[model samples]
Target: MSQLDAIYQLHPKRYRDKIEEESNYASIENQKQAVLSIGSLGVAICSLIIFLIPYSTTIRGVIAALALPIVYFSFPYIAISVAAERRRKEMERVLPDALLLISTNIKSGTSINRAFLASSREEFGPLEDELRTTAIEISGGKSVQEALDNLRKRVNSGLFQDTLKVLSDAIESGGNTAELLESSAEDIRTSLELREEVKSSIRMYTIFIVMAAVFGAPILFSITVYMAETTTQMWSQTDLSGEASSFASGGSTGLSFEQPDVNTDFLVQFSILALTITNFFASLIISQISNGNMKEGAKYIPFTVSISVGLFLAVKTLLGSFL
Candidate 1:
């Protein structure tokens, strides 16, 4: 084979297959396309690193080689993370509008199917998209139940899925679909409102945490700094080297290894960083608890650590005159 043909043969769908392997691309339809998406991301990230590493030193080249795989995997990670975040924001924004739409339609005495169609026609972004898809499917010869199921499956939105499932069940049972839809909408609305109230309350918790990290830590740190300064003054004046070498025979002799000079500066810096990070994380956890989204809260761990530490040190230095 020619060189170009040989290269193609050797690397036949290499990146796509790697993605498939990583994803265990099975059971789900369209998985091959998803794998291809992963392939595109990995190639984009890795190729950039490879091109840049050519001009680097040997050690830098080695570092690039080591980091290449991580970057490749991280590309897909970034894609998934972004998609998930977008979907979450869309769901949250669409929910209240969708509920309001259902309530308005039911109050005006419209059938649920026609109400769903009307909601689709409205320009309320994400909910409109899902309703449009379901409407089109139902209009295109799909059964109402099947269309709802298909819409839920395609969107993979938890709230949307639950709403449709409840409506579908109610309709299938020959029960009052209108009542169920209105009741469900109101219930979801109440949940969203409760979440807002919780957020407001949690702000108070944040103030408590601020008191601990800001006021309490500084006071404690001041005491420690004073003690460190006291020790430094005594150590600086004493003949520590000669006293350091002397070992006593009795158990109470107290001669030990020569202690390193205390650097209050380092302690001050460290205390600031530690207290700040501690406070930041405390606030982040309070947010999670208030929001009722523990899973979402976990991702902010790194942010909380970085912000708290940075803020504490910065603030301490800024307020150094007061201390």
Candidate 2:
């Protein structure tokens, strides 16, 4: 067996099934091999970069090389999640319209199966595919409730699932299906509008957080660290032997000029680490405020970190040149 096949075989069945489900949502075929290829490429690039860094310690390189394999192996999963989220969002955007169309069909005396099939228009995107499948299942030997349950399971969206569950319950109770669908569509539209309003109201908070984490902290740390380093350098070059001797001779002014014990390298490393952590949490907070999901912020992590670090380096360089 090939290396990817070996890895896939070693992976747990549940995890493999989850990957397959996410892959289906992402419309990706043969995802196991794709994930393996992506992970291997990422690890190779990261390990090479770690090893090639100038003046990097052997221990650091070895540790990074060891850790990167595990970290980069998750990249494909992250990618799949992002793609699936895109699909979910597309379906969500068109859900209300689809439901309204289905309600219209139901009011015109069409069966639920036919209504769903008719609602599977091209503009509905992923929801179109799902509705068509559900209709097909209902037309076959499967019952309506079971087909709808399958539809809910196929979608990894809370809103979609909840809507389907309500529809299923209505079906079981023999309620007015057309009116129920119309009301559900109206509720979904109202919820989406409220979400937009909430986002608008919190726009300033998101801006403040992004600015502070990506711009303010980096600039401040760069200035303070550069000053500390400059102070250390200046103290190192100053002559303090005469001052020490005068103090030893019991001079009236007991003054001493000792070199600073601060390590500039440690300061720079700490600043970078602090900036990274700050940006990471800031991204999550922004995502939570805007999207209501912390994982949605993962896409912003790299962008925030890169911009903040780059700004920090630029500020440090500018200060060094000016001073």
User: Highest TM-score among the candidates is held by which one?
Assistant: 2
Deviation (Å) of 137 in candidate 1:
2.1
Query: Which residue runs of candidate 1 sit more than 4 Å off their true CA positions?
Result: 1-97, 100-114, 121-123, 154-159, 210-234, 241-258, 261-284, 298-303, 315-323
- In angstroms, give how far residue 35 of model 2 lies from its true place: 2.6
Query: What are the models' TM-scores?
Result: 0.57, 0.89
TM-score of 1: 0.57
lDDT (10s digit) by residue, model 2, range 174-219? 9999999999999998988998999999999999999999999999
What is the Cα-based lDDT of residue 40 in candidate 2? 78
Superposed Cα deviation of residue 220, candidate 1 (Å): 5.4
CA lDDT, every prediction?
Answer: 0.62, 0.87
